[model samples]
Target: MMNEAIARNPQIQSMRYSLSSRFQAVLLGAALGEILGTQCQVMQSQQPQVKQPSQWTSLSRWGFSDSTLANRIAIAPAWGRVAVQLIKGLIRGGGGETSWINEVLDVLEIPFEQSNREPNSERNSSEQDEGSPLPDFPQIDAGLAIAALPIALFFHADPHQLEQELQQADKVWRHRPELSDGVLAISYALSLALREQLDPTQLIAEIVEELELNRDRPTTTDPSAPSNSANFVEQLRFTQSLNQTSLDRATAQIRDQLSKSQTGLDALTIAIAFHCFLNTPEDFCLSVIRAAQLHRNPQTTCLTAALSGAYNGISSIPLSWRSALSRGSSEHSPLNHLWGVATEAELQQLSDQLLAAWSGAYDLVHLLNYPGQTFAIAAPKVIRPH
Candidate 1:
């Protein structure tokens, strides 16, 4: 069964990485990006919605070092939770809508009926106190792009299915069309990475072409806001010109371009993610850290880290951060739990299951667990930590 599944998926066979390495990297990188990026987010807030923890008082001084504060703090972003649920939906539901939707809403503690209802703006403000859970469906931003990771991975070989699944998955947010564009761009980029077809020089161009093509679809086109594609395209084009400059200079250029284009927050965040990734395509740590520091937006940083991970594979992530992710405790720690994945081994298991589903090898877990079983997927190279 394993050999037949592998035989059917020639795309993975030709790749430079093992299926497990890329899958684990994407999940781990996104989680780490959120851990570090949200710290920056919290530090930037002068009057935070939740009380600031004392440990983070010196965040500015730590500078996102590999062995420092980022590994110790586990701040789970909404995107990580959403990505996990999406994985469940794909594997268990067989791409069915209800399974994934319920999985996602269940984690957020929101019922399917309540998903469509707008939050009561006039409700008591005290309900959002420190002890309260993060709100379901927080404002749609570039970070939400990470939630579509499963769709990209599962449907990378099928462009039509990839686009369709991405759109269906995005509808849960009830966000603006522009936000959907950002999600599509990020998802498509991941799909390209998984196929080993991603070219740093041509990534922006390809994404812009995809956005334009999607704009032609009746469901995505906004006749009233026709300039949506044009605006995003302009911002993305500017990123392509960014060379191997310092993170500060690259961030400044991104800010200047956004100011000149007068694009929305989602656009700015997506642009920042692309700029950070393009500037340091080979270094996952540097790319994600630059993203986190870019205007202190967790979503931008998380998405940037995800793209870097997909491109570089899991071996590229720093050892200290990987150790923290695998060993971190979930008790009172939001970062550790991504749909019951509190440790590195659990996340890797989930990734393997996802790969099994994608490859049509439903019994992969059984084969992998039994020492007597000899089934193994061949790879071009063995992945190892740097």
Candidate 2:
């Protein structure tokens, strides 16, 4: 009788899915959140009354922003080394004409000729002058968070190693302590979730403590010094305190404390609050939508969705939403036009390569080796300090 009962359940007979699926979900969720959040902001501006959740259907076009683009770029071969070179160029006073910029543009598949064109003919003479420093990387603010995602996933099981890698990666942020801290907190939280150590209610407090410890330690031995204000930690605590209250009150509080300004700390706080409010993986879509409603900026919503999706495997993401995204027509889907390729199959392939690299079965070099991409080399194991 017990055998017969077990045989009746097909779910029990299915093979277990791989961790790669979760990684893919994380990226997909971030993309979806960005699309939904952007659309919500448009709706809010167009109409005074809030739109019903049901009004948002799969047919709606989802367009990804720079945040998603940066995330995709971060997945390229040897991205850390590329980031290091870019930072070095910045410090050396390299202008917009720096080779690193071209390298980045190449990897992103953006047309190199586009850089030569003036942003706008209306710009002041001084702005367009040859001496004027080319504007720093346009997406540097949220790019920190996006870059940290792959790093966090790579070092998910080792917090100590994760911290070390993050410290080394701080070169990308230069003197922006708050920005660096925001990225650190987000990456650490994602790491914990990946390792299944995340407790939504206690997550904020734990991260605060971790940041405090890192801050208190002297950095003379380190290449980059820590650069954060007390307000970042305090804000995190404030957000955590609201977890005991109703979601409505928590949302209202966060909306009041954080402005529409897309500051690094503000973005991180919003993501943390949404994660806590939802308090469960099953609430991923709703949490991201609420985050979007809280702010029009796509960064906060993208970060929130990525974190939630990391915690909840891809299976938990609503099939309807995925279907809507996959079936979006070119006329209705902004993603295809903006990103060039927006199919589910392409995303899955990227996820597979990333997962392979993370698992030591492949390295960045192997993944980037065109035509001979099938050849994989063992990834070097990350050694944690004793």
Candidate 3:
């Protein structure tokens, strides 16, 4: 029965479905990003809303890194893994727990295992000093517990309960210092989505307020405005910055119309624009990409990463990007009895091939700004200390 359940898992099943071969093909395309993407962060903030998320955490998309929304769905998951690993690594290192963004790969190297270990670990720090490269996900219980929360939320026994927990977490996060920028972004996107179901009017109010703020408009001049100044209802919504008097009513209507949508990629479509506000504490550009995915938007990342991966580089794609370390044989596949996937070597080659073919941006703003276009920029920006 346990095996049956694991066999039925979506992500697990996905690896068995004919889709698995394509996944390798995609992975192959990604190799170019290892060298190409580091140059992407050089594209300075075209404006405030598009700025990279590594600065200060705020509701401003201007700070989003040049990571195109194309690859966000894929990147988000790795962030989930990395965030959990850091907390656990820190605890194991005797630093106890710190911010969610503390680097875990630096201090400890552990396999991504489900089993727990001793609280006061017997492992030596000398191992790190000896120069062993860190493994992807650390084998720490605290990290697993924290990392598992999002996964559980993704496939909760009761999504409503998880939503409630998320709401509570959001409130608690507002006052917590240890919370990372990625966590806050995840919280905000979740809040926006939850509000859509629980108190839709509140969502509208926020939308209206967000638009007004974007346009530098007085949300409500009337004295009868709701105590929550942001609760003002408006017929139009525009996230465009500064220029309220030029309210493009048609465009605002379109914005609201789009939000009402539940089509494929719509939520993530808006999410990429929304997540641009995130700011990670470390230089891990992948955290921001991961934050975009915590909301369950992977296809968005696939496309964006193909294009923007060249600029953003692999570092932005969390080190935990590989969900599976070794490509298990077909015996483990769901089709063990009926079919088989490519061998590990075949899969690796396919992964590299697919990555090399990826030419899409991971950031959505780029899509809005330039659709189906790829061009070289002036010399990429110089590196600065994190």
Mind giving the per-residue lDDT tens digits that candidate 1 earns over 157-178? 6777788766554334343545
Q: Which candidate is the best by lDDT?
A: 1
TM-score of each: 0.72, 0.64, 0.23
Query: Distance (Å) between predicted and true CA of 270, model 2?
Result: 4.7
Candidate 1: residue pairs that collide = none
| lDDT for position 275 in model 1 | 82
Error (Å) of candidate 1 at residue 62 is 2.8
User: Where does model 1 exceed 4 Å of error?
Assistant: 1-14, 44-77, 97-138, 169-175, 220-229, 244-246, 255-263, 326-328, 337-340, 363-386
Error of 3 at 44 (Å): 6.0
Off by over 4 Å in 2: 1-17, 46-139, 218-226, 260-278, 329-332, 337-340, 362-386
* lDDT per residue (tens digit) for residues 203-280 in model 3: 334544443443352322222222222211211123222113222342343346446643312323333322222222
Cα lDDT for residue 292, candidate 3: 33
lDDT of 3 at 372: 34
lDDT tens digits by residue: candidate 2, 1-386: 65565466532333133356567667677666655555555555655484434322321333222223222322323323333333333323322233343554454444433334565665545554644443334444554565456556656667877677666533344445566677778888877676556777677778878988988775522243345667567666665566566656866777776654345444445445345434544577666765664455556766777788877768767776666555535433433432333565555555556566556553344454542344332224422124
